[model samples]
Target: MYYPTIRGCIQALKNLEIWLDKAEQHAAAKGFDVGVLLTSRLAPEPSSIS
Candidate 1:
């Protein structure tokens, strides 16, 4: 059970990195600053879980 949980966590992190890289590329292709994209968030407020 713990092994599957750990694997899932690792996979989630890898997926996040992949998404960030894609965002960076998309920003560059659109002639926008990657920093702007990086700083922008989908959430208007901070999460309690973090």
Candidate 2:
């Protein structure tokens, strides 16, 4: 039971690594800084109430 869960987590991490590699390749091809990809956010920052 736990083995499958652990395997899934490892697979997800591997997939993330592959995606990051692809992102780096894309940045190189586009002549952009890899930091741009590293610093990007998927969700908008929460606004503070005044």
Q: How well is each residue in 1-50 modelled by candidate 1, as lDDT tens digits? A: 99999999999999999999999999989999999987887776666547
Best by lDDT: 2
lDDT of 2: 0.94
lDDT of 2 by residue, 1-50 (tens): 99999999999999999999999999999999999999998876787432
Model 2 TM-score on a 0 to 1 scale: 0.79
lDDT for model 1, please: 0.92
Model 1 CA deviation exceeding 4 Å by range? 42-50
Model 2 error, position 13 (Å): 0.8
**What is the alpha-carbon RMSD of candidate 1 to the true structure?**
5.4
Residue pairs clashing, model 2: none
